[model samples]
Target: MTSSTEPSLYAPREPVFPRRVSGPFRRLKWWIMAVTLGIYYLTPWLRWERGPSLPDQAVLVDLAHRRFYFFWIEIWPHEFYFVAGLLIMAGLGLFLFTSALGRVWCGYACPQTVWTDLFILVERWIEGDRNARVKLWKAKWNLRKWRLRMTKWIVWLLIAMATGGAWVFYFTDAPSLARDLVSFSAHPVAYGTIAVLTATTFVFGGFMREQVCIYMCPWPRIQAAMMDDDTLTVAYRDWRGEPRGKKRDGTTGDCIDCMACVNVCPMGIDIRDGQQMECITCALCIDACDDVMDRIGKPRGLIDYLALSDEPVERAGAAPKPIWKHVLRPRTILYTTLWSLVGVGLLYALFIRSDIGLTVSPVRNPTYVTQSDGSIRNIYDVRLRNQLGEARVFRLSVSSDSLLRIDLQGIPDGSDVTVPADSTHLQRVYVTAGPDDAAASTDVSDLRLWVEDLATGDRASRATTFNGKGN
Candidate 1:
């Protein structure tokens, strides 16, 4: 129905087969992949001794009880500001790293990159490297091809399942969850989350790969804002690489146009075409180009980790700038300062936080109950939180306002109120104003409710008001 002049918005996917190459950058990528994947698949299994009152898992999100435990630190719902501070620091950290090193996190630590590299390793192992993969793609369908394809897919499925399972472990006790998963006894939500994550991992890692970096991720679009002239990124030195051909016949510059860099690039971009948004700056092209340069008996770094600021300098015949010259500029300094301040504030708060907490809510249905002795009484709901691992007795007092006297509903005047380990105790409290004070005071009296741990002397307080009538 459309006119021929209208161009199609969708472009068909062209599969890329990245060639295997050996150089320093390639070795660095291998180490990064190993460490990142190891941390992801193994962290949930780490244990910490938090006593019997809490889970021993070093990192856990106990959603049912509204607690987040990270090793020695346990966070309550009221202290969520600590989590917010951490999130802010994470954002600033990203900005700092992005400004300093172009897409380094994307290349090294991102789960997508790590998993995609793993999938590619499997593919190369089964289907052979770059050239063989290209040939197989064009080859006719047969038993040999189908067998290899099935084997690769099965291996990918196992990895995806493991990835999903590791994520679910963060929300519960890992060993128990593993047992429950095998026995089909886990909660429906757990199973649903695992299933969904498994599907996404399989699709994203095994099939999508670099398409995720190019079209799916928003980081590439925003990364340009983080870059400056002095920011280091993988680059092709066209000054040395241009006028391309082999060297022996006196027909070329240093670059032979052998296409080694293009073949090894996972994003399928020509680094020689200048910087493109599609480049992940993974440095694989640098490895490929350097390998080719070495073979051709030319100085390496035809494609290297260099900065745009150096390009003009090199062209003008000036000495190259030092590596750390512009790295500590205003932007990075501001980011680092902000990140450090939040971390320090959170640490201070954690160190000074008390093990006892108190909250009070006034009951308003009757407002005031006139006592038989002509005194005024107000009912309140008091909640006492015990953060320690052992049960303790807490004494409640309400003496800030001279006219207000406090009493708990169920307990006799002299009895102790006991709070269980890591739990809250709720009591209906009464505030009474004697006839003398009620007769002389205003309609409302502001009062303070304080709770002290009888065993440890830890204390906290909340302020409230007592209703009364004055002449």
Candidate 2:
């Protein structure tokens, strides 16, 4: 039985005081942040010449027009399979990364983590570092503190607003939209989106920081299922650091009970306590521990990223498996293969996709009409899509029995029908078959319609059936 005086297994969580450190990881993080934020803010402004009629924005999701434009590639609402394929590829890529490295995305690449870190940096710049901020929080209200808090809030609001502003640029012609926005002539929906995003960024990045990772994100929950014993995760060298106590002159373990690892953890978790759900595996604690080790004349990596079983075995003088083998395990291989396959398939599909598309729908009201000439006639609604950057002339024809003929009522037969770039044309078409050639009067017979580009000779065909009534 545990006595009242005995220490509880769980200690009250102490707020992290994370001192800034610079290393390879820190440099990589900085570069990633710069690239990601640059792309986010600037991508919508990039222009692609897609003719005068089409939107010039390189990547725009024109939901109102039921179209998506990405540089040279345009996707119609009917081609949602591309979007699905993209999503699948992204998922498989995530799985592959998780299986190989474990939580690197959470630590460095997650938007929440990145934004929260940026907000924290702003707070630190305004209010000073951990100890200073702590002291200010404890002190009574004063003019200096008030001014600092106000400045921090103003900066946060500016950042959040910029984030929102950049997001709105993606949906419209960026330069024109920017001009409209500056003139206050933009849509109210744009303003509403900016307001919502600003509020969320300010609240989540500034206040809800670690809470988002710990409680709100589903990634952490799903990560558990994806991770294995062999996966490399941010971990403490418990075998070497344990029997933890203050260092002596000659006899001692590596740890000096300085709690540097705990103090520098962004999520305020103690690495020495072993892995927990709250750990983002940021490796700031590794930097902290390394600093402490240098100061105490001990080797670094007391708390480091390592495989759980391997670290213990190493401490006990046992050989461990190669890191390569662990990373290239069965699950990782499967995810990698799937990711590659999907990526290749998407690339192939994109390269082979046609600039013209044609779809035909049979008129439902009267499936077939018995003409005065004792022939069968069928009416169809044909939709012609021009996915190119210029208007196209397409010739429509019917192919079935030699006696079958296509008639365009309002338009001339074999005449060039013009379709504007990135636009769809809906036209009424009729197909007629002589009674002698109409294979079966009692049954529906298959008929094919061909739509060909007059200049390029590119063509698309759709099949429909002409219904006939029995005598």
Candidate 3:
């Protein structure tokens, strides 16, 4: 039933050159850039008092030691579930925010958008605005142009290198790392990481720009599915702006076909063409349109933030539902509830989590050995994890019948076993009992091992099974 002449659904890409604009959105962007960049550059230098043996950096990921330290809290390799929980909470928060307002994260908080904006600021500062830069590119080589281009590249490269260098400082003591970097005594991998990050920052922020959001990044596509009609997005009020005509001696409609919105977009997509995939919702176009409206002596917001479902009638009085209701809809409420619950649960777990861990594995080849004195013996490989920041002595004991006893190969009965902080201790342990005290011959036998901290009287236990041969 389909006609053969219908064109394909896809449309070819068109390049955009957005002109600069200044207003509230621009001011918000400036503040965000300052805050985010400041945090990224300065956080590594902040120190926290974590007693004596641990690194003092406020936040550090000590990969060499398999530890993550954030101020007073420290996490070991086995505590990766905490990290996973944080990631889940972050994902849910993104979902909730996206459901309430479209692409707010992409516009305001995304590192890609922030960095690209910074790079563009550098470009504009050195070269000029859109028109001036376009003209400069078309003009022949001259001293003025050469000087500007050289200055821009130098500044951009320095910022890129600094960005990369600041990242590696989080892994070690920031001041010490800085000294090592300057002295050329840092690890080779550290240098390699800096080089890779610097190259990526330059290439992605300077040249790729909108292409990253459009083709390379997956968020835009995922966001489309996540959004609903009620989500507030930067939209063109097509109902009012349409019948768009040039202002010739006092036009009837508000729009003057100035194309200011098109010129100011960083992604270079005409917002008038409906919500396109490339739009990051930066609100720069809102600033541009407002300026145009002010000059033409017309009411602003020919292009503004509006929900897709809320079609504006010609009459000015048709008010939609309250904005808060739209923001706190069912999907958003669900996401927020889940995010909060998980966050609280993770916090509780982290606060009460044990500082010591015990693991016991029974020998497989010979489940039990028969001693000459009519005693049954079993060998176990025990692993102890010390997650604290200081060395501690722990006593190992077995809990069972009174006739049963436990012994460590090199340690005496009831002797203290010294374990260093943030390290694991592995040892062979033997458990013996009189034949009368031994449990019945069964595939599974109940066994419990307890480790007690001698300094603080804190104790932890593990429940395992002692396998035995059939009688």
TM-score of each: 0.94, 0.93, 0.92
Instruction: Show pairs that collide, candidate 2.
Output: none
Q: Report RMSD (Å) for each prediction in the order shown.
A: 2.1, 3.5, 3.8
- Could you tell me the lDDT of residue 113 within candidate 3? 89
Residue-by-residue lDDT tens digits, candidate 1, 1-471: 346998877877889999988888889989999988888889899999978887899999999999898888989898999999889988888888888777878877788988888999999999999988898888888888898889999999999989998999999999999999999999988899989998999999988988899889998888889889877888888877778876567666788989999998888889999888888888998888888878878899999878889898876878678778757778888889988998899899999987877789999998888899988888989888887778889888886546567788788675369888888889888878888884225677778888887877777888888777666
- Quote the lDDT for 40 in model 2: 88
Instruction: Give the poorly placed runs of model 2, Cα more than 4 Å off.
Output: 1-16, 412-415, 439-442
lDDT of 2 by residue, 75-114 (tens): 8888898999999998888888887788888998898988
Candidate 3 residue spans exceeding 4 A from truth: 1-17, 248-251, 312-317, 440-444, 467-470
Report, for every candidate in turn, its global Cα lDDT versus the true structure: 0.85, 0.83, 0.84
Q: Taking the candidates one at a time, how many backbone clashes does each contain?
A: 0, 0, 2
How much is 146 displaced in model 1, in angstroms?
Answer: 0.5
Q: Pick the candidate with the highest lDDT.
A: 1
Worst 10 residues of 1 by lDDT: 438-447
